[model samples]
Target: MSSEQLAIRIEGLSKHFSVYHSPLERLKHVVFPGRTKGFNDFRALNNVSLSVKRGETCAIVGQNGSGKSTLLQILCGTLRATEGTIEVNGRIAALLELGAGFNADFTGRENVYMNGAVLGLTRAQIDERFADIEAFAEIGDFMDQPVKTYSSGMYVRLAFSVAIHVDPQILIVDEALAVGDSRFQAKCLNRIKAMKAEGVTILFVSHDVGAVRTLCERALWLDKGNVRMLGDAFSVTAQYNQFLFEADNEAVPTSAPKQIEESIPQENSAEPPDAQQAMKLHRPINHWGSHVGSIIEAGIFNQQGERSSVYTAGEPLTVRIRFEPPDHADRNTMSVAFSMKDLRGTDLIVSTTWDQNPTGFAAGNGPLVAEFRLPNHLNAGDYLLAVALEDRSGVLPQYYEYIEGAHYFSSLTEKKQYGTFLAQVSQSVHA
Candidate 1:
């Protein structure tokens, strides 16, 4: 692609740090030169390459030691890469470590001008935007106080306010927004959405998968000094989540489940319906777990026990999940769960069989079916379903079969609903 079409481009980027055992060993190494070897080289990033278009928003996800911060620091020009070339086409504004560029001795107001100057804003520009920054920060009297007296949330509020109001062409955030309260975080997200709409290139680092899927178009998953996966936000985050789940359980399945045919079976027949027929797996469907058991079929049905994908508000609904049971699997340790999520992938409701049947159910020779019945309290919107079969025998639950986007449904109502769900209310007002 042409240089003008891209906001950020990197090639063969790498960073290495030298580790010294002690001060004496470092001195010996410095004094002896070729005679002494006292340090080991640690690579934080290895030959990483990426390209982001001018108006695209991308997210970076990884564990603590997975080089996520190192990559961001390099992009923000706070750290140097040992090898490779980087091209950043536009002016960059970064929110890295909390209180990174702030002077503790200076009041919030002074810090604002200083930060603005550092970002290449002249005194006139800073004066023109100071009022908006102050109002957005919402620090009130604290704005006149030294930063030393400010809370963590206050620091993030001021930093984020200045970073956004400066009219940056490129924005880089490194999880600093997580320190803010829920309301402030929501406000920040809405502002970010506005920025995205205005074609500001954004690179966000966050552990919240839901946020990544909701805000970003693409995501990069980093592992120990390497790129594990890079693709659309939803698919990349789904794979990352599965890796975490399996790693926590420390169990690798011997084999994967057999793929089912695409034909749908009769509801009254003994055979289970095909998963593909219940919902359109338009995008990739993620299924991962031990091969001991698997979800053969899943569907959402109405009160008449007929398959349906659309429901009226307050109507009765049933979710049926059919799966094979592992041989000699412990009944007490096995459980089934299903969750409802909005189209954006935010979880709205979750129900588990183990919550009701703590003692567990009996083992059967044939395929077992679990049905979850509940009233449709969801507002008028499209939704997705996720189901899982887990074995809780160990310290961490081991998933036997976890299927994401197993089914899709929609709810409709004549009355306008306010939020995600409709809550039952009984009220009387006195004049």
Candidate 2:
């Protein structure tokens, strides 16, 4: 990418703070500065470097106190780095700390104008997009109420609404969606999707691994004020999750055979079962556990029970999954389940053996098949199927094998529908 196409560039970035043991030490340092050793240097960021291309979505993830927040604050110009050379190419709008820029005494509507101005929008521009912001926030008459009286969700709603409406070339989000309800979160995600399509550069930070994997193309894993890994979102997030599961001080292997240049998505395919399959383009971001029992094969079947990667909406669909059991496996403790989610990571349907079919399985002598049937009520779109095998005999449930993006299928509709769900309707006019 050309330099003009770079949204952000940084080299040797670091931040340090001087910490004093007590008030006496602070006073001594001021009175007899040269004679006293009163402060210790605490490094929040240490020699970090990264780049993000224009219109790309990148994610920063790490444990608490790992400088993820500090990095975003520096990018948004809220905090200054102690040592670094930074370059930015466009206007930036950020929702960093909660109520960071809002005036608690002012109403939500008043803060909208103020925040928009801070983001480099004129009064006229704010006025033009005021309605859109309000609608997107959906806080109702709360817009007229003082921000101090608003709840956490209301605060985030107004904050995110203003940030997105300012039309900045770069947007920075720092775990703001965690405050909103599920529906509001989905709305915000959809809005983020729209912004990305318009070539808006995004820098997101969140503990929600699934959200990070779904929204970001590239990921940067920060460990103790240092770069742990930098590569494709799925790859980095998968390795980070493994590290968390281990919870050991030793670092997990993060090296990949090939790095994805500029974090572009990879094409994926699944072989057809019998008949010729349609052009199936998308690939599942598969991450599995190191359990003894593993998913050997997973397939999508049509009404005629033929393997397919595509199906029509309102038609019969089934997901047939087969698993290989480990040696001396206790089948009585096993449970199988699956869930379907749309492209945006919205959970559409979740089915489990305990809820649907609670049956004990045979021994580990042979392969086991778990089939799920659906009425095909999903709207026309791309979807992913995730399957899990759990052991529920103990006090705490254990995931024997959990595979996501295990299979993918597209639903075709005879008539265009609006949302991700399909519902039957009947109407009659009275004369």
Residues 159-262 of candidate 1 have per-residue lDDT tens digits of 99999999999999899999999999999999989999999999999999988988998888889989888877766787788889777757553454465423
Clashes of each: 0, 0
All predictions: root-mean-square deviation over Cα? 5.5, 7.2
**After superposition, candidate 1 runs with Cα above 4 Å error:** 28-35, 251-284, 302-317, 324-334, 342-344, 354-366, 374-383, 391-398, 408-431
> For model 2, how does the per-residue alpha-carbon lDDT over 283-402 read when each residue is reduced to its tens digit?
435443446235666656787878666788778888777776545556777787788876544457987776654555865487777888877888887777767776667664455566
Looking at candidate 1, the ten consecutive residues that score lowest on lDDT are 263-272
Question: What TM-score, to 2 decimals, does candidate 2 have?
Answer: 0.71
Per-model CA lDDT versus the true structure: 0.83, 0.77
TM-score, predicted candidate 1 vs. hidden true structure: 0.82
Q: Which stretches of candidate 2 lie over 4 Å from their true place?
A: 26-41, 131-135, 138-145, 248-287, 293-333, 338-350, 358-367, 373-386, 392-397, 404-431
**lDDT at position 2, candidate 2:** 73
